[model samples]
Target: MLRKHIPITVSHELVHFKQSPLKKEHTLLSTSIREGAAEFIAGLISAETDGTLAEFKGKEITRLL
Candidate 1:
């Protein structure tokens, strides 16, 4: 299952990279919080950029309660 998530993980990391430069504190965020936010934004980016978030819908269960 994890093997199938490489693209989603990369997308989330890309989102984090885009946010890193604008965050003022450079403080560390918990993995859950950081990954949750990245996943959410990346989902939106996927929907907009690729016309669907289906590839990442399953990953949401990990980040959302």
Candidate 2:
């Protein structure tokens, strides 16, 4: 399963990279929100080899991307 969907993972990491600011302090809620937003954006832009992954991802994110 991991052997596939590398694009989604890359997209996810890229979102994190887009956060140019290196904050010294932030609340847990803020950090969680950041993570969640990254995930949501990545999912929107990520691709699927077939419909299978699209369906699977809709249910749950197995891993990165």
Candidate 3:
């Protein structure tokens, strides 16, 4: 599972690097949005989504629903 996610991880970090004016607010909501954006975009860019497993969690929940 960890190995499968590496590409997404790298892409996620790269997305963070390219992001301008990185948010560093001291609240959970802000942090969640910032990280979630990276994860969602990274999945789209990296093409490492779990279509087979249908985890239906996190980023995929909205699409699944």
Candidate 4:
């Protein structure tokens, strides 16, 4: 179980790290993209690429953009 989550967790953290330099408050769009990017990258690295962990029925976070 823990092993299964490693990809997504690491991807999520990476996205956050990339956003750390943002000097302004986060907007809904930015936040959505951040999470979406993490999810996307996670999917790419995860063995289960069917997007079962997605909040919606899409492969990318473009739905929120």
Candidate whose lDDT is highest: 3
lDDT (tens digit, per residue) of candidate 2 on 1-65: 37566787778778999976647888898888887777787888974431244555567657996
Q: Give the TM-score ranking, best first.
A: 2, 3, 4, 1
Candidate 2 error regions (>4 Å) = 47-65
TM-score of each: 0.41, 0.61, 0.57, 0.52
Please write out the lDDT profile of model 1 over residues 1-65, one tens digit for every residue. 35556666678778888764545654456555776788787677664231256877767655645
lDDT string for model 3 (2-48, tens) is 78878878889888898776445557887788778887898899877
Best-to-worst order by lDDT is 3, 2, 4, 1
Index of the highest-TM-score prediction: 2
- The local lDDT score (0 to 100) that residue 33 gets in candidate 2 is 87
* RMSD in order of candidates: 8.4, 8.8, 5.9, 5.7
Model 4 TM-score relative to the real fold: 0.52
Error of 1 at 48 (Å): 14
Candidate 4 pairs with clashing backbones: none
| Superposed Cα deviation of residue 8, candidate 3 (Å) | 1.1
Q: In candidate 3, which residue ranges exceed 4 Å CA deviation?
A: 21-24, 49-65
What C-alpha lDDT do the candidate models reach, one value each? 0.64, 0.72, 0.74, 0.66
